[model samples]
Target: MSEVTERRAAGSPADQRLPLLQLLLVGFQHVLLMYGGAVAVPLIVGQAAGLSRDEIAFLINADLLVAGIATVVQSLGIGPVGIRMPVMMGASFAAVGSMVAMAGMPGVGIDGIFGATIAAGFFGMLIAPFMSRIVRFFPPLVTGTVITSIGMCLFPVAINWAGGGKGAAHFGALEYLFLSSLVLAAILLVNRFLKGFWTNVSVLIGMLLGYIVASAMGMVDLSGMDARPLFEVVTPLHFGAPSFHLAPVLSMCLVVLIIFVESTGMFLALGKITGDEICPKRLRRGLLCDATASFFAGFMNTFTHSSFAQNIGLVQMTGVRSRFVTVAAGGFLILLSLLPKAAYVVASIPPAVLGGAGIAMFGMVAASGIRILHEVDIVDRRNQLLVAVSIGMGMVPVVRPDFFAALPAWMEPITHSGIAMTAIWAVLLNLLFNILGERGRDALCGHH
Candidate 1:
């Protein structure tokens, strides 16, 4: 047998080891894929709290540091804490609306946000075992519907990036469109002609080419980067001691529940991509990692952390299933957090370029979901109704972010999240039409 084949046969794809260079490059590719999202929570929360430029920068650094630590623990794992999957951890955007609200409260500022985060993290950890039991509900019917909704929800983010990012001065500029197209074309060409490693790094190569073009067009901004420090360690509690309030803690706990639902879908999606079965035990580990990471994030001056769904697409596109790639990516995140200049350089990659890659990657996620659905008894009327209605419900928030604004404030956590919405409906519908329906049939037979 071939040496490569022998090596692959020796371990599960998730445990396979690659060459050091491949590890770094592939890991960096994962990093690039997720960096935009990893920093977004801090950026939004910082601005919402009216933090100054330096304070925001501090928040970003703290977030990166915590994210790095979380990702490593998740991928490498320590005992029962991590899932040991190729999962990248990042601050959860699901918490943004709640956090923004908390930021505006009279006494519940950033400190209260952190305090609530800590409480919620603890709450999540406590309930993770119970939540993991929900895996049985996610047959192909529910998994496919939720995964499809995830990709569909992300499409708007991709389109906005293609238009030069939301709220950019040159939003929808022709240059941004051209740049996005160029990057997309490059990626397609690489995937068409390249083999093996080249194909795996296609997105990275496309982004690099786009970055060069953007630099020539004066779109790669490096202004004021030199003024930033050469190195700095993220000091925990930089925002001061957290002061918890009952209301904020409860709100954040709701966000944690939302995160758990979202992470379950993401973990299952990754499992589908990597050919791993996300058994209940494994799901429990993944949830524990998320909870532990978020708990630490509160003290480390960051927000809640969850498995990043976008990276699942990269794994699907690249066909690299090694969890260590994420370990290396976590290492890079640590370095970036320490070296402000390095982080800025990576941050400079135009959103247009990312948008180009995102179209392919995010579309792959949707495709994977459809592939899973292909295995379902899709011809059955009940299953068909389940998939159709779940996905439609999932799109409500994506189609109109404020659709639930008129609803009570407490419902925001579930209503705002398309993944959560999809999962909830799909599970309930599955129980109604499949599990409970089967029991009803048995009872009728007994009566007869």
Candidate 2:
């Protein structure tokens, strides 16, 4: 084995310890990296449920609190729960459509949503061991396609941010583009010219510069800062006691399954980046954390929880593989949840600024996928087809989300997400063209 591989086999770099200042800065960077996504599901669901402004704010706080706790558990671990990696947990967007549908149902309102979420979380924990076994199907060919698809899937989000965020009054403005480009340029410059720690924090430094410039241009919106309470605690069952229904519960279970698949790709990607071998045992533990977090999230007035894919890219870009950084990040998230004013300040960061960093970070995820693919026997025609078809299947959702609109609503969880689609197609294709094919050839040889 190579020296690097041997070292990785000895121990995960994710377990490494860093200085207090470094941990805080890097941890804060992770929090900033995923904050928008962390709160996005709550914002969408809150608005959809016709919640009052205070109620929506309450939902955001609850989401952050649970997400912080989940991140901590996933990084620090509790027995068999956490994966003990640099994972940042957040509310899964995969559950949005289901939860929104439940909100619109006459008898199943926010209460029903929470009930279903809680049920699905328990179901997820039960099935996580089986789900982890799917990791065996994800060889380099499949993993690369899935990882590349993940990055491709996130590109539109970055583009939207670059254009001043979806539904912004000044969407597509040149100023937004310039600011995003400036952040990207700044990150590149820092990564190129700097060394060691400075290079590792390039994204954070670039974002700081972008935020300063954005503030100077009067783009930062702190309009409602004074209205938000200075301090508050997330109250469980804030939407009232959850009332479970079969349909909503089933729908959420489907979303959890999709989360497991998508998270599998993310975990493998992180393992590849950190040079840590993700044994099946560790994968199961990570999924269990996800399940347990989601279960508690229902009570906490949040949606399902999963590892944030965007942060996977940040890991690749920054090369800070320490899980403790994520633990520190969890601390910040908990602090933000309790301190609304602090959360608002972080939230006020313009989407344009995040877009700049997104371009680099998200692209790094795709590049890492490609790097893994480099080891595959790409010269073979079957492997070529496996990759080509799976990636194309994955892109269907990204290029045209509505392509699967005609499909049954029950299939939305699988169809709407590019990562999920890629995973499905890649696994199936690998089974058909590789595993089964190899078995068939061996059987024929034995008969001969």
Candidate 3:
């Protein structure tokens, strides 16, 4: 392992070894923290492609299988790939816009999206070293703005789930609201009163109790569910050979670029939490894991892969930074993947139940960004404008989805993702107002 200066002390929480039982329980908590996000990409893409319910179920299993592999590879060092951090890998929400666009295109569908994912993964891998060198570009101002935008963009999805999901017959029904409120309240109460590990798994406790209540109220019904085999193997190209096209490939490549930038901030933030210095080599290795996992995801009949930002919050909340915990979580994911019935049970959780946890998890992400920004010199006029306008640009899609409708279809990939827009604006604005300007340049050189 590469020596990391500024890493956690030998006896620090990050390096402290726990008993096997505690490790497993803590690992499961980490999985629960990220499970909702991990399953969402495949669900969205599969439904967008108009796949049947059975196919969607298969997609969910495939995604879990691949995510398990990625997480293990990330948390457990592998040749030149893994970062050896407590990072959990999963499908990236950033690619949803491009993948959904490809799904709707004529003569292009799920296969096309997978093709683009594969190509972009390779492109990202090739550029990982180069991308790592630009860590300086992501000062607190830029990173904070982009992360905040990501959480904001995802908030609408949580809201929709709370309302019984998009296009539901009983959307916004009183039952849905009540169920969501119950789960949210449970989570808050647990977090407030619980200590140590119990607090760490508050989301899980909340969901379990909410499920029980929902079942009692007849809101949870599995009678119409299809029977899944006890055990099944994941196959490559199960949907057919991937079809390659220029537009989709380019769009997805751009999305990969966005993923890398977002991941940079995540890595730096993790470094801060663990008291590690994120050297260029370590960053490249981490990014290589992301890209390689994405390449494998295509063959596994899944979408693009990236580190789950929400897991960072879990690490902070639990004060357990051992990568081994995540490794165990990866094993559990693999076990669940092979057991189709078990995966279906998790899949069966209603969107409303997920909504309660979603708000807390996603909101924590935005709160982290704000915490990062708190260290910046907000009184500086340039910094203030940079953050304000970047956030405004990012919220364009969240507040008004059709604001760019009159533009060409090609613009949809960028416009549809608030994170992508926010990242681009934040970087460019920082370059223009901070790094490139004489005053800011002098400030960096200590000439002031």
Ranking by TM-score: 2, 1, 3
lDDT of 2 by residue, 1-448 (tens): 9433465577769878798988899899999999999878999998888899899999999999999999999998888899989999999999998888988999988899999999999999999989988777777778878898888888888999988998789898989999999999999999889899998889999899999999999999999899999999998887789999999999999999999999999999998999888878889999999999999999999999999999999999999999999999999999999999999999999999999999999999999999988867778787789788888988888888899888899899999998998899888877787778855443222120
Q: Candidate 1, residues 216-299: lDDT per residue as tens digits?
A: 999999997988899999988888999989999999899998899999999988888887788888899999999999898999
Ranking by lDDT: 2, 1, 3
Candidate 2 lands at a TM-score of 0.96
RMSD per model, one decimal: 3.9, 3.5, 2.9
User: Which pairs of residues have clashing backbones in candidate 3?
Assistant: none
* Local lDDT at 248 for model 1: 91
> Candidate 3's residue-wise lDDT over 1-448, tens digit each?
3353234334434455667876887788677657777878888999999999878878888888888888998887688897878898889988887788789999999998889989999998999989989776777677677767666766787788788877568998998888888888987898788787677567777888878888888776575445778888888999999889999998888878878877877887677666666678888999999999888788889988998877776676566778888899999889888887776666567778877777776787687778768867778898889889998998998899899999986677678767778888988988898778876765333232
TM-score (all chains, Cα) for each model: 0.95, 0.96, 0.89
Better of 2 and 3 by lDDT: 2
lDDT of 3 at 222: 73
TM-score of 3: 0.89
The reply for model 1, stretches above 4 Å from the true place, is: 1-10, 439-448
Considering TM-score, which of the candidate structures 1 and 3 is the better prediction for this target? 1
* Residue 272 local lDDT, model 1: 85
Q: Which candidate, 1 or 3, would have the higher lDDT against the true structure? A: 1
